[model samples]
Target: MRLGALGTSSIAWRRTLPTAVRVPEVDLVALAGRSADKAERFAAHFGCAAESGFDALLERPDVEAVYISLPTALHHEWAAKAIRAGKHVLVEKPVGVDAREARELCALAEEHDVVLRENFMFLHHPQHSFVRDLLEKGRLGTLSSFHAAFCIPPLPADDIRYASDMGGGALLDVGVYPLRAAGLLLGPGVRVAGATLRTRATDGLDLSGQALLVSPSGVLAHIAFGFEHAYASTYTLWGDRARVTVDRAFTPPPAYEPVVLLEEQGHQERFTLPAADQLGACLASFAAAVRAGGTDSAREGADLRHDTVAAMELVEAVRREAVRVTVDQ
Candidate 1:
């Protein structure tokens, strides 16, 4: 249960993740960052003293697990290193900016027989499963298509999400959500057919991007993400017999309780359950996987490969689509 944390900035370990996840009771052994003062402050806040820079923390004997909340660019490198250090890793989304890197990390983890879990806490959240249940149960019969959008206004200029060298973009950041939702609900093998990307003037990252995911089952998954416009976190599944939708699917999930809504034949149903504290739950799951001798779910080995490959493939596809439009014009 000893956990090492990298990049304590973005998610604000003190703010976003539950105290149950970061507290010393969970074996919060070390905090690593580029700044000594920041690390010290974080350690003081969490009531731990074994703090150091990233490389130094990796050298510690007590840190058996690592949670990486670093910028997108750093995730692959650090996660790979953590795996090499014989630590189970829980990495934030995208896993890598590309599939090859993701595959490499996965291989490295397997080479060591260490658990590697993607911190897609949203999927771990209950709402996603609840909605998927409705779809699987024929509540959305003869599924026609899926549509989702996740967007937020751009942050200040200092935001790492705007750094191209760090693999920042709407596609890498917010875009993955709707795409992940599609894969979860419609099955993997989601790919981009066509798309448009419009970037903000600040860093030329995708301020707004729209794309279509062609499901192999002949279903269309239309998805969008952006760094501007109103904030939205929602998904809709359109079917001949009914429709399913979810609100606030990605974040600040008040526990595992997922809110699910179903509409069929002019009748509607809404469901909400108390959420499991996912941050705590995810931490517990990783620790249990470690003690139990392997990854907790079958999805880790092969599903992770297919899922991340599909995600990266679509990211490239969308980027290429944007390029194609410029070339054609």
Candidate 2:
């Protein structure tokens, strides 16, 4: 699958592009950025061509698919355009600012007979499959509760994530990780029970937040995220008979070994999982889906579209139901 990139963002330069170039199934064809110098630099670094602009990249006949690392606000617009151009699209997470935008983009992809996917790269990590195996074997017994948190130190004032109009907020950025993880572990039909947000008085962008959700079977999930805290990315699942905790749950570096802790009555166990390149795995999956291009591909696309829309719906619900608190800073 010939792939073009639509942004010179950090994730594109740091993770996605490097991984794409390594995937045998993917051919890195071109890169586009608003700044020609940056685009040329990125393309040169990755050994691909540099396009004049995003539209130019999309217009390339050699580009069969596009990776959109643009800001959250630009996701729907560029993804819609790419789908209409008959290009499979892999967009950064949060797919859109809200559910409506997500639904519209999905509809466009389906109408144009193209594949549209959101880049939740963590889901591609093998550690998650390992956890599922433990769950299936009753390692955690009957699940009773889950807790997740993803927090980070504040960014520079000029970072795009501090701009409200650009879809910047803890919820859209880090909060979505725990939220999506909940759905991944708890299954579908999880509903927001209550929520809270701490917003900056100057810009109304959320700095931190917490949410409570319950699955259909009554298992509870507690999720917390923030842009003003010591870094943490972890989750714990509690069951009637035992409990399991995962450190570095969300953004593990490709070479970092992950450890899962399991505890029961008078016994504790630790399992260390192999290091894996999740971003490479994610890009490879996208390439395979684009290459498949038939009923099977269509089914995968439909399933991914559904997951994207469902995640957005959960985000929207949190925003709507959250008890708002403004901070003077």
Which numbered prediction scores highest in lDDT against the true structure? 2
Q: Candidate 1 — what's its lDDT? A: 0.76
Candidate 1: tens digits of C-alpha lDDT, residues 1-329: 77788877657465433453454346777788767888787777776654658888888998888888888888898998888888888788879888778778877877888888777767767667777787788877798899999999767877888788888877898998888888888896777888898865645667678898788898988888987758998889999988888887777545445667888896988887676655566666667777777543455555765676677777778888863222110
Residue lDDT tens for model 2, 1-329: 89999999998998888889988988999999978999999999999999999998889999999999889999999999898888999999889999999999988888877778889999999988888888889989999999999999999988889889988999999998999999898998899999999999987899999999999999999999999999999999999989999998989999999999999999999999999988888988887877777222355677778878888899999999999999987
Off by over 4 Å in 2: 294-298
Off by over 4 Å in 1: 14-25, 200-203, 255-258, 295-300, 323-329
Model 1 deviation from native, Cα RMSD in Å: 3.1
lDDT of 1 at 86: 86
Question: Evaluated with TM-score, which candidate comes out highest?
Answer: 2
